[model samples]
Target chain A: MTCATRIAFTLALATTALVAGTLAQSQPPARYGLGRPATGDEIRARDIDVMPDGRGLPPGRGTVAEGAAVYAARCASCHGKDGEGASAERLVGRNEGDSFAFATNPKLVRTVGSYWPYATTLFDYTQRAMPFQRPGTLVPNETYAVVAYLLFQNGIVKEDAVMDQATLPKVVMPAHGRFVVDDRKGGRAIK
Target chain B: MKSSRISRRRALAAGTAGIVGAALPASARQNPDTTKVQGPPGREVGARSPFEKPVRTAFSPARTATFTPLQDLDGIITPSDLHFERHHGGVPAVDPQQYSLLIHGMVERPTIFTLAELKRFPGRSMIRFIECSGNGGRAYRLTTPTAELTPQQTDGLTSTSEWTGVPLATLLREVGASPKARWLLAEGMDAAVMTRSVPIEMANDDALIAYGQNGEALRPEQGYPVRLMLPGVEGNASVKWLRRIEVADQPFMTREETSKYTDPLPDGTARMFSLVMDAKSLITEPSYPDKLEGHGWLEVRGLAWSGRGRITRVEVSTDGGKSWQNATLDEPVLPKCHTRFRLPWQWNGGEAVLMSRATDETGYVQPTTAELMKVRGPNTQYHFNNIRAWQVGADGVVRLAGGAA
Candidate 1:
């Protein structure tokens, strides 16, 4: 290798090392095998992801009263009268200390409090892909209210814990401790 | 020693930068072989044309992903109709005229290209296998491996598509990505908003935003309009119904990446983002749910593939993991595509444990569950690519072993 090339590589390595050391927890687009960073318009076109931590949440909130009307109008057919998901899907429920099952029971499948890991996921998932008949139509507040009612059904928060950016991220989940990150490679298998 | 040290350090750095990095060692980077590179076969040479009428099944009417007739298929390219479907909320009906991809993020100029615009660019075709990472979980039990399953259900998780698309690098270059970009978050327009993170270097090299599958418009289930085609990576990373791609400095930690796809290793820590499907093989002809009539002149056949690269060799065992003999691979063992292997077995009505081990061209050999568990520890239920065992009963009944039979 030429001395010039060597120096260029050394600079790249030094830069990469610095980045890898400090930003190891969250590398850029390429680290996770993506190509490049997203542009503002690109992010705007489909930046629907809302973190359980309220990172991508938009500005809005809703009341359980409003949610009842919205649910009946859009979500009731497939999600059932109370978000049970008619033939489409189950919207809530989690029996504590139980693994999630589909055909167990209506009471079992409709408890959002028992199964979902994050409250924000309920909002994000519902907002991004809910109602079945029509998705991505719910306003931010409608999503929050649906999320609030689902939480109340799960016995998680009371009827009053407002489901908004500030309040949603703080709701400690019942099944939060049930998950663990995967750590299983780079060596011989141990019994 | 000083000069040698300099070269070694340089090679390491180059390897780290990867092929898509801004600068590459001129000597190490091979020029793109545009000559042998392919496009959709213009008109089929009398075979089923690229745009043939859909294959029909008189028996059942399950739409979306159809069941491949495993017993009839000679090699690995599943008849397009038979490939499995795992779509969320069913496939969406999209118009090609309305299809366009918007590339934004750390790039100098974000650009949007229509389907026709994407086709105008220099295009290439890849014969790759995109198996769901959880492809072969069924049939650990069953005597007489062939009895494990009917060819359709037993050998359906895998499929090969000769995809045509513009190389991801060409678009990335046009957009002018920044050197600091390390991650790419890919999102699908499906109702679920399936999103995940991909390393940029990988995208810069073998990734393609494929709009065509098997010579036609991308199937809705296969991400019609346009989808991300990441060669040699996990199928999930290749987002179907792709809408937007964002270059970033960190992973988005999408629910699919964090909660669902991750596998738990023997250690308390789980395999957070196991992107590549390890080498795996299954006997297609005489496998479970499939019944063997008699053992006169049995043709031993199976499909073998590796996510890391191409398959170099496959060894078959009539007596389980013991006494492995080489199986002749059908020639043209393309990288990332299913390579068929055949072994003429002379079974004289004896009991046996049937297994196959696939080795990739990268010299990373496929290990048995026993060997894999040695490193990953035990209790790994997901991503199990262990040597499958099929026991043959005296009464000619083949079933899964370990009492699962």
Candidate 2:
């Protein structure tokens, strides 16, 4: 090779090495292996979340009649006898008519019947945190019962309706159609 | 001649007496030294002087939140003790020795990490702000006049801190997250067992499993042993007292995300998962409850921040919204961090209205309350980042001024 060509090749190799060294300094190692692999049983113990399409639901069934008894015995103290709200949030009221008008008025209260858009959220919330004082203590059937009774009181379900994993998702909430996904991305436009 | 000489001697004696009297006080004056006796021995840990403390205000019967004294702070970083707190359930006390975080579902290796084990991995730190979406709830109430409201009562639910932790991306790589996993559910150990679904893309970006705040172990009120820190997101998304994470293909639609944080609109439809806090600014000094002494040569100082990126510019309007001028931004304008801005004004002892507007690096301008209300409607509850105005009266009293939007 000519002397000029050899010098150019040497300079290119040095530059490449420098760039590689900088890249290595900026990137983290792929893995550290600091934590232990979790066992299947360990995961199942805490993986109690349920999705919108009826995923992660435990097998159980409950009727409105059964739920009425459960609500009176365990929930009535906090959620009120008729779901009109006592010490806690009101669970039933103002489900029909213009929701926008009701929401604008500060005196008008927001409840499960008037605001919540998804029925599955009721089951998930009740199962995870309900009866306020004793959370995660109710069995899946009891949770289904409470949800069924609440829905029935809201005029969304019949008095004898039963709620289970298969039937719960099918029960359409009154406010189901009133929720829109967020469309705002950061920009000069307000929307 | 004898009488004149006697009068001159008398005058001389009087002058001597006056000089001696002035010297005596100069020699005897040790008031500061007298009061400067040794103070009590220093304690093992230092504390702010008894006179200095951040005022805390609680909301609701359960005292679920303690608002920070934003008007009282001087810099961008909020002292750890003075950080604002909003807890659905009371703070949980978790022992570092017993603390463990579980990562499962949609992963090649489901892993359990102890506090010590997590710290062994590579760590990263960043200064960021966490603001609750419902920060300006009280401002929306039409009954309360703007003059009656204080900055602490309006926007005290936001605070910034320097957090240190293991990068969540590093930990996810260690456990090997599946490509199909698009979201992850983070659950806390608080009594409510608060849970929120986070997008996987955020985790791989700048998320952290934070264990330190302001250079010390996380405060119990902040999160204790560990917490999730998602930069620039709503405060609730960064779950405190974090315990478990479940990788999944879809959002879990937990109660916190569905029933609570969602924003309602005028069209009867609610907006869900509206997580990012928009650009906002607030004038801290010469604000409500502070009366100017003389109203001349006042330095208008305040803070500006954006969840999307760095604050590019801040403009102050002393004549309400009629005119504007750019304010000087403090140095080290970090992204997703609070930037302190200042403007010098000469108050002419006349009635005036003051307001600030923030424009972020993304070119998103902070909207006026009227503009925000047009889009969000009167029913919207969260993410209220609008131009706030404080009026200075001829009597030198500054009051909040902007009617219901």
Best candidate according to DockQ: 2
Give the per-residue lDDT digits (tens) of candidate 1, residues A1-191.
Answer: 89999999999999999888888656334312223344565657677777656777888887666677777787777767865656655666666455433222323432456545677767777787776657788889889887777777667878766777798889877656545543333222221
Error of 1 at B318 (Å): 0.8
Global lDDT scores for all candidate models: 0.65, 0.83
After TM-score superposition, the amount by which residue B386's alpha carbon in candidate 1 deviates from its true location, in angstroms, is 2.8
For model 1, residues B1-405, the per-residue Cα lDDT tens digits are 011111112212112333333353343245445466453356644555222222322122425344444444676666555555665556877788876677777777677777877887768998888776655444432223244344344435567888889888878777777889988778887776677788888888888989888887777778898889887666778998887777777666566665456554433344556776777777764554444555555766888887767888899888877588999999779887889998877666777667777877666566665565554544333465656556655434455553121
DockQ of each: 0.14, 0.53
Q: Write the per-residue lDDT of candidate 2 for residues A1-191, one digit (tens) a residue.
A: 79999999999999999999999888867787688988888888878888888888789988888999999999999989989889988998763373544335555568887777778888888888787888888899999998899999888889989899899888777677777788888888986
Which residue pairs clash within candidate 2? none
Off by over 4 Å in 2: A1-27, A98-109, B1-35, B143-145, B403-405
> Per-residue lDDT tens digits of candidate 2, residues B114-220?
99998998898899999999997666544444555667778889999999999998888889999999999999988778899999999999999999999999999
Q: Worst lDDT window (10 residues) for model 2 chain A?
A: A95-104
